[model samples]
Target: MSRIGKKPVELPKGVSASISGQTIEVKGPKGTRSFTAGDDVTITLEGTTVKVTPRGLSKRARQQWGMTRSMVSNLVVGVTEGFKKDLEIQGVGYRAAMAGNVLKLSLGYSHEVNFEVPKGVTVSSPKQTEIVVEGIDQQLVGQVAANIREWKRPEPYKGKGIRYKDEYIFRKEGKKK
Candidate 1:
């Protein structure tokens, strides 16, 4: 009954998958990643394809069916192409730079904010106002970008701050004088 679970994940050329009990490991050009599904769902690898099915008609089983399938799909994509997040800084003198493993940010604060990059993820600053986060894990990449953005969130009035490349800021009208 899960639409997404009904579609098996197809592994592209140069990609392979292995299953051990409730865990499935996907190896691709980029890297290898694994996921462990709940007992409510069963995981199986057929040829180069991965499939997920529910164990019973229970609600938890149905919920895990689609979620497990999506997790498997993410693992495949993560190991193959990886994930990337882009952020840009706004406002005068606001900028970002990379100093070895640390990301230096100048967002109108009194002092520069030094963000130490975590393991398994890479952060780059191609331009003074541009920041790029990359990694094989989608969750890690997104979390790193969010943590950076949290330093100086975009304001509704002027929209001046660090934000995702494609993120939109809803503007509000200024107070009448």
Candidate 2:
């Protein structure tokens, strides 16, 4: 038995879910999201609770069942309450700014990099070094943040680069001669 699958997701107020065939759609105040059910996964709605169960106890099937359930639950909640990701730019002359639908980042590079913000997502910089990404889709928000951070990964020696707000980079000292 899967611990996560055993637990049913409680539907919050103002959020609604609809299941059709192998697709589940969730709509809320923020926006709407959808997820495709796996082959062996079964999704059911019992009153205000959503349940996911697998056809068999196979390793992969069981794993997918739990993950699908969690993803569906997250979709419902994310569309209702939304999701956010914070990133920090570290180093001299490293900063970020929003211009129209694009985000311009200066990560100690010779040329500035412009990232086009996707629809339904908002990128804001409270400070030159801090960036906040918000959207109803958790996966998209995370992917966008990761792509932006990839432009300038943290260097081990100086520990300077773009990184998530909660990410920690352990630094190592140079070898002594």
At residue 60, give the lDDT of candidate 1: 99
Query: Against the true structure, what is each candidate's TM-score?
Result: 0.98, 0.94
Reference-based lDDT, each prediction: 0.94, 0.90
**Candidate 1, residues 1-177: lDDT per residue as tens digits?**
999999999999999999999999989998899989999999988888888999999999999999999999999899889999999999999999999999999999899999999998989999999999999999999999999999999999999999999999999999999
Q: How far in Å is the alpha carbon of 8 misplaced in model 1?
A: 0.1
* Residue ranges of candidate 2 with Cα displaced over 4 Å: 175-177
TM-score of decoy 2: 0.94
**Model 1 root-mean-square deviation:** 0.8
